[model samples]
Target: MSDHAVSGVPGGPVRESRDVADLMRWFGDAWVLPLLVGGTSLVIGILLIVWPNVTVTAVAVLFGVYLLIYGVFRLIESFAADEAGGTARVLLALLGVLSIVVGVLCLRNILQTVVLLALLLGLFWLVGGIIQVVAAILQRSRPHRGLTMVSGVLAVLAGVVVLSYPGISLLVLTVFLGIWLVVYGVLMILGAFRLRAAGRRSVEVTGGAAAAPAG
Candidate 1:
């Protein structure tokens, strides 16, 4: 009999189904997934950069789509057993939900959503820069502390500029967003390779253990 039939015969279907679900959950942990996601982001960033004159609505829609994809990626990452803990998973889920909500809102209202997103981005940068500055100060003895402080100051200045000029031209905003996306995509791609290396090491260790003769 087929495996499905065999599973059905002994009430093994539940166990089989659970196994399938577990497999599906772990599938996203593969390195290729992040690489694919990063490639998609890179393409979107390139398109935005090349066609900076695209309509405002188009830009908004593109951002919405990107945010949706990012949210899904975050959700998948949260499910990786080897990565996030319970608290991290919860935070990632919340962040995913927020991204989805913001994306949907952007799709519904282009102009307003763009402005609001810019404001939110500015606020986030401001807070992040402040945190970085504090961390750098605490690590003042580090060789790169001055560089970190400079970066934090630049981030804070960028945030202030964006906040002060909330009505910046769409082209400028697109350029900034495109650059950010490209950088983020590159980072994600690098991270994917790192994860792949880690997975390989884990497999090697597991294989070595399995092959060892036990007492």
Candidate 2:
């Protein structure tokens, strides 16, 4: 059965197509569940930030749990999805095993874990920035050079700060992350509300149409 139907709005005979486009845009329809899982992880991440000491171990444990579950799911999905060929199945299975191993390692090493994750992140950003700079140089004809340059500069600056003061980077990184989380959380909440409003309007319009006198 089709998931959506085209029905006229309350105001007119115009056919309103019910589009799952938003869902598709945010995440391919098949990836909706994973997105939800990821969103939940984001919330958990925020909680971990709020109580870092208390949460460090929990966070590590959660990651391990999440990764293991995700890997298993991917492995299973690979088998079910027709588009996933032999190579894909093998990759998914490997990923599943790797995830489980990583999770176990994280749990075991959670005690010795340093707060230098930010520095590692900074290094990643630096590498990414450098790559972008190179790409921009190579693609001088592109109109996005300015934006790319800005991103590269920002990433390099962030990297430098984290690397120069790994000791102080923890607090700074946590604050920066908290700010981002707030922004993202607000946006997601707003989006959920908007989706709910649209759903309500759709239901009302459908209800109204059914109540209309037959002409």
Winner by lDDT: 1
Q: What pairs collide in candidate 2?
A: none
lDDT of 2 by residue, 1-215 (tens): 22222234433333331233333233223333434444654675576567554443554555456556545654654464333345544544554555566556546654343364554445544654565455445444333345445555665676676677666533455555444333333443443444345445555666565456545
Give the range of the ten consecutive residues with the poorest summed lDDT in model 1. 139-148
Runs in model 2 lying further than 4 Å from the true structure: 1-36, 52-55, 115-215
* Per-residue lDDT over 78-129 for candidate 1, one digit per residue giving the tens place of the 0 to 100 score: 5653333465555556555656666676677645555776776566447545
Q: Estimate each model's TM-score.
A: 0.68, 0.40
Distance from true position, residue 215, model 2, in Å? 35
